[model samples]
Target chain A: MFKRKLFHNAYGKTLPYLLLIPTFAVIILFIYWPAVSSFRMSLYKVSPFGNKTIYTGLSNFENLFKNPDYEKSAWFTLFYVSFTVIATIFLSFILALLLNQKVPGSRFYRTLIFSPYAVSPAISGTLWSFLLNPVVGHVNYFFMKAFNVQVLWLTTKPYALYALLFSSIWKALPFSIIFYIAALQNVSDELLESATIEGAGTLRKIWKIQFPLVSPITFYLVIMNIISSMFQSFAIIDVMTKGGPGGYTTTMMYRLFLDAFAYQKTGPASAQSVVMFLLMAGVTIVYFLFGERKVHYA
Target chain B: MMRRYKKPLVLAAEFVLLTAISLFFILPILWIVASALRPSGPLYTYANPLTLQTFFPTTVTFDNFVHIFKNLHFGRALLNSLLVAVATIAISVLICSMAGFGLAKFAFRGKNLFFFIVLITFMVPFESIVIPLFVLVKRLNIDNTYFALILPAAGNGLAIFLFRQFFSEVPTEILEAARIDGASWIRIFRKIILPLSIPAIVTVIVMVFMFQWNSLFWPLIATHSSRFEVVQVAITAHRSTEDTSWANLFSSAIAGSLPPVILFFFLQKYFVRGISGTGLKG
Candidate 1:
């Protein structure tokens, strides 16, 4: 009995580690090893074939800062992230509040809005590209018919970025809307009823009570929107304009792709990757530092 | 009397606002379907582009889809996409759920540390690591292979975390009872835990499948030839080619989106439950 019990205990003790081996192996191989390799690769000047390498130290990083295109890409990324994050969150918040108001056909409307969540960013960009086509786009048609202004939506400076921004905000809405709707529904009715009894106006009641109640979700969405706009918006930018109109809409991530694939500047590309990773790390640190404490647990 | 009148007015205003927003979301989707059906020509010479005619095709046809399948080779790309997504789902689900089960049911040193590492991995985005990942795949000579697409995406941290959360909620007493009955851990997991956790498994499957299906950047780097182009990458390649038919591009775009959209419609509940369960908000 003693031997059997010992054997059982031994199996139990080893089983978790055995199960964990595959996950750790993949993580190490794909994530951590790549991370280390990227850092190392950034310090070298890689050949055209990525086989021959020469040590370059921080010169690759220095050259990136010296390059005007990289600076422009960074600025564009900042602008895109801020615009998309704020616009998406604000629009979704308003939509969520209105959706929660017991409107007629709310269920149908909810499905309509959330359906876009299923569409990939690439497809969303295509759909938007059709809608904003310079020659035959409906929006431009409306512009011409109503305002007599012929606007270039996809191939113009500033306007191309706006087109990209529009699609980004459009696709980003469903996630925020879903969360906001859930948060709004979870807000206790008794609290709202008491506020109503106190003769609080509808907007006032929402701002003072419901808004604070859902602030945790709002905070969380803000961080996610920032990260998404920073990183995942690459698909939209790629599909919409390919960071075009003289690189007006080329965010850093897209620039990284252009450098590596288009120009074959692997060392600079890896350095740009390290820069993006640091930027992401900084955002995460800020979120934990400032955003987490503001999150109210229900 | 004032209250009765005011409520209806508010409802009417809300209705107008909602209709406008819903149109904003739905109109573009309608436009894609409309564009796919409408006969192609130069600009508005084909049809009135902005009117109800273009928004809803007067004469609908599947010519563009036929073109995509026959000429653009999107049919093969769609098959490749299916194979990649299925392989990713099969491998990721097995590994993640097994890890989840072990984390949930077992006790050992470094368990919390292992989970923390998973959490940290989740926080790292693929974009930041793509270069090195590409190099690694090339070094292994798996680039452009099915394993290239499948392996990188297989060990999903969020899925593991999700599975852990679900499995942890399974009562420990049941597993203890099984152990007392002399059932081995693997048998108990297969017989008791997995069957009971079907909902969670379904949720993970749908989530992983959607992710793999919709993936663009990695697949773009991983494969170079027409033999390995997934649907999303194929769409981009199609778009970039000069003289590619706009109608066919529109049709292919819609075709590519259909799988996930259809899946979402069928599995809407699981998507919602998965999002909320994974703590997307908090």
Candidate 2:
């Protein structure tokens, strides 16, 4: 009887482990293994024909710092991340407040604002590229007609980065709006009513009450914006500019692409990826450390 | 009465602002549709292009859509994308649901460790691992296959995490009653748990399907030829060396985006619920 009891207990314990097999296998084979391999590949030099592999200790990192293109890409990446995060969070907060107001047809407005989140980046990029085309774009025509200014949106080096930012923000804003809407809905109606009764005006109510209530969502949005700005913006850059008229908009990931696939410098590309990974991971960790304490669920 | 007047003014201002924002969002989409229908001759006119003449098609035609299918292999790309996306959803949902059930219901040793692994993976960006993943795929002889796309995406941490949260909220009494009735663990899961978990399951399916369908970079890297190219790649390949047929390209793009748009319209209630529910819990 004791033996049977022991057998049943052992079987029950093993069931969960059995269920976890598929997930563990996938993570091990794909995520964990590749992560290790990336670090290992950072230690070697790769050749064009994919034939040569020479062991290089820390040389790839040294080369990465020395390269001028790397510096430009790094600066561009930082600027892109900061600009997108700030603009997205600020705009989303305002939209959220507007949508939360007890106005007629507010539901329609909420849905319309969130609609852009459904469009894929590929479609968004295609549409924007068409709209911003210098020759026949409606945007160029409008600018010429209205402002009497013709800016070479994609072809010009100075203006190309802004075009990229414009397209990204247009695609990204809807998601931020959705996040803010969710956050805004959870704010206490009683608190707002009390604030109004206390003679607090609109801006002051927002500053004193709604802002603190949604501060956690703001923190979450900032972290997500940084991650996406770094990793996911490559698609827009790829489709719209192909990293440029002359690599003027070449981001770090774009440059990493050129290094690995185009130039066949796998070692340095791996090093660049590692640096990006570390930088993003550092940001996330810091955000969690300082930001988590301020995030109130209720 | 004065407060009532203030409310109408607020409502009118809100209406105007929303209309402007919606126009800004939808204008490009409208242009894509108009450009797709415009006669090929009128597409390249450089001046005064915003007039009603260019706003609507002179003669409606399906030539661009037809050309995309014939010249760009839109049919094959659609099939490839559908297969990859469906396969990813099936594999990920199965693995994640099982893992989630185990994590939620069972009190096993090292459960916290497993949960931590999932959390860490969630935080790590795919770009950080793409290089090594490329090498791994090539080494495994799976570089050009659908498996390359499907398997990696199937093991998504977010799906598992979301499922775990949802499952944990289910009442334990239901499962205990099933156990007392001599139902095996698998039987209980199939009959009692899964039936009750339909809402969560639908949420995961829609989210995973969208993510897989829109994925670009990994597919760009993993697959080489047009045979394996997905819809995004197909539209991209339509841009030729000398001149791009913007009409046909945008048309194909609009067509490619149609599935998710339609899916959203149908499943939006569940989608919103799932997002808000899991979002707050996280």
Q: Compute the lDDT of residue B281 as modeled in candidate 1.
A: 35
- Tens digit per residue, CA lDDT, model 2, A21-106: 89989988899888778777898987767478899999999999999888988898888889988998898889778877777787
Clashes of each: 0, 0
Query: Candidate 1 residues B236-258, lDDT tens each?
Result: 66565466556866788789888
Calculate each model's fnat, 2 decimals: 0.43, 0.46
Interface RMSD, every prediction, one decimal place: 5.2, 5.2
What 10-residue stretch in candidate 2 chain A is worst by lDDT? Answer: A1-10
DockQ for every model comes to 0.43, 0.44
The reply for model 1, stretches above 4 Å from the true place, is A1-11, A47-50, A289-292, A296-298, B1-6, B46-49, B70-73, B101-108, B111-113, B123-128, B164-203, B224-227, B279-282
Q: Indicate the TM-score of model 2.
A: 0.88
Q: For residues B165-203, what per-residue lDDT tens digits would candidate 2 score against the true structure?
A: 677767777777778898898898899878777767777
**All models: lDDT?**
0.79, 0.78
Residue B48 C-alpha lDDT in model 2: 55
**Which residue pairs show backbone clashes in model 1?**
none
